[model samples]
Target: MTIRLAILASGRGSNLQAILDAIAAGTLDARVVGVFSDRPDAQALQRVPEALRWSRTPKSFANRAAFDAALADAVAASAPDWVVCVGYMRILGAAFVQRFHGRVLNIHPSLLPKYKGLHTHQRALEAGDAWHGASVHFVVPELDAGAVIAQARIAVEPTDDADALAARVLTVEHPLLLHVLGLATAGRLAESAGHALVDGQRLYTPLPLPLNPT
Candidate 1:
């Protein structure tokens, strides 16, 4: 069965494009049912049919809860088995997370449990970390605190700056996300008891990225 996905994005949507490209190339057994964004002008909304695109500025709503409620309803309308958030900048509310609960996933630009919010590349560089990468994890209301599903690792070279590190991480994030989604589409992954489950077993740590070319 093809997994239906609802994408929530707030930026250029490069990862969103990756998913669409993978589907078109028959590398992924999934279909994007909708693409929603908090920024009305977000470029990601253009990747899908106009009817499948939903967007509105957060300021248009009375408050964050109202906005999240509305956003959740829009996403729910798509009936996706998974809600995938890529570069979605807004912090989701508890109510919205509870609505979807175990079915929402997000790809963060940091190794997670590390940089939970923005400026991840700079944080890793400042800390002199030898490694940094992206993580695909369940999205709880606590902002990247959910159990990680898997991650792609890239060495932080001695000469690397924030931009260079970020660019490199972006390359790996695509493949990492696709790999994790493959597990989801195959019915081998899920959020179980606040932990990540793969093939009905607990994921003790984020799985290393597969050896496929990125």
Candidate 2:
């Protein structure tokens, strides 16, 4: 059975586009039932067909929980088997996370457990780290502190700025996101004994890619 999916986002959605492309190409067995955005002008919303009931309104809700409740309602209405958060900037409430539980997946633009918060590329470049990457993890209540599903790391280039590094990391992110989504859709991705398991094996931490000449 195909995994029914809802996507949430708050910005320009390169990750969202990657998922859509993967679905279109039959690499992932899923259906994007709904696309919801907290921002009215989020570019991700434009990718959906007009006939689909996509939403971009959140100002009407009174509070954060209320917003989450409404958001949850929107997602439930779609009846998705799982939800994927790609570039979704909102810190979802505990209630929301619990409601979805193992059904929610998130993509972060960092190696994770290291740069769990923000400014990842810039921070990596500034800190002079050897590797920079993106991660896919299950969404839990505590920040990015969730079981990691998969990660793809690229070596930090010698002459890299934030923009240059982000661009490079994105290349790995696109494929890695698709692979995770495909695994989830196939029910091959699961959390067992506090570890994220793909095909019954623990996911490796941050497989670093070799830096290329720019």
Candidate 3:
């Protein structure tokens, strides 16, 4: 059974592109039913067919909850089995989180529980962290505080700035996100009672990335 996937993105949509590439290459057995963005000008919209692309301005809404409600409605219309947030800058509301529940996934630039919010690479650099990477996790209501599915680690070079570090991390992120999605579709990855599970076993820690090359 092909998993029906919906992607919400804000920005360059590199991760979105990665998923599209994976589907095109027959690496992932899923179909992207919709690609949504809060920013009307988001480049991610370009990756999908004209009918699958959707965009709405956040400014039109009176408040955050109202905006999220509209966003949730848009996602619901697609009837996606899974909702993936890739470079989606907006913080989702509780309603939206509950709507998708365990089916909603996000790819954060940080290893997670480390830099939960934005400026992850800069913060890691300032903290003198030896390693930095990305994590694929469930999207809970409290920021990025959710059970991680998998992570990709990379050593931080001595002279690396935020941009340089982000570039390296992104290279791993593209493949890592696809790998996690593959697991989800294969029934090897899941969440139960708020805990992440792999092959019906509880996942105490997130699975490490590069399990297989993209």
Candidate 4:
């Protein structure tokens, strides 16, 4: 069966595009059934075909629950097997988290368990960390605290700032998202023994120094 996917984004659709490209090239067995955003002007929404359903609801719908309900409704209409958050900036409520459970995935710009929230690049530079990168993980109620699936790290160069590092990290993020999604769509990724197991093998918990470009 082809994997049906719903992608949520709040900014440019670079990550969304990566998934689309993967599917187009037959590297991933997934199809984007829907695209959604909180901001109607989000560029990602434009990437979806006119035939596919896309929505942008009020950010302050009755409340967070109402917003989640609206978002869930849009997602369910697509009948997707997975909901992937590329650059979505909302803090999903617990109810929404339980509804999706293991079927939801998210990509964070920084190696998780390190910088859970925003300003990650700045935080990394401020802390003087040698390496910084991205993570693909299951979406839980906690902010970027879910069980990690995979991570791609890049060295933080001396001249790196938020914008420079973010751009570099995004390069790694695009492919990492596709790789993790491919595993998920193939039913080869799962949580086991506090780590993500793929094809009966444990994926590395985090990317280490002397980072690889992939």
Angstrom error at residue 53, model 2: 4.8
Clashes of 2: 0
Q: Is candidate 3 or candidate 4 better by TM-score?
A: 3
Stretches off by above 4 angstroms in model 1 are 210-214
Candidate 4: regions farther than 4 A off: 192-195, 200-210
Estimate the TM-score of every prediction: 0.97, 0.91, 0.96, 0.91
Each prediction's whole-model lDDT (CA):
0.93, 0.81, 0.90, 0.83
Candidate 1 weakest lDDT stretch, 10 residues: 205-214
What is candidate 4's local distance difference test score? 0.83
Put down candidate 3 lDDT per residue, 1-214, tens digits, no spaces. Answer: 7899999999999998888888899989999999999998999998888999889998898988898998899899999989999999988888999999899999999988999999999999999998899999999888998899999989998989999999999999998999899998897877788889899999998888653222
Residue pairs of candidate 3 with colliding backbone atoms: none
| Per-residue C-alpha lDDT of model 2 across residues 26-137, encoded as one tens digit per residue | 8888888888888878888888885544554567877788989988988988898888888888888999988887788888988888888878899898788998888888
* Per-residue lDDT of candidate 4, residues 1-214 (tens digit): 6899988898898999988888889898888998888888889988887677466566558777888888888788888888899899988778877777678889999988899989999999999999889998888878998888888898888888799999999888888888788788788877654566778787666423346643
Best by lDDT: 1
In terms of TM-score, the best-performing candidate is 1
Candidate numbers sorted by lDDT from highest down: 1, 3, 4, 2
lDDT of 2: 0.81
Candidates in descending TM-score order: 1, 3, 4, 2
What is the lDDT for 146 in model 4? 80
- The alpha-carbon deviation from the true structure for residue 12 of candidate 4, after best TM-score superposition, in angstroms, is 0.2
Displacement of the residue 34 alpha carbon in candidate 2, Å: 0.7
lDDT of model 2 at position 79: 92
Q: Model 3 misses residue 89 by how many Å?
A: 0.5
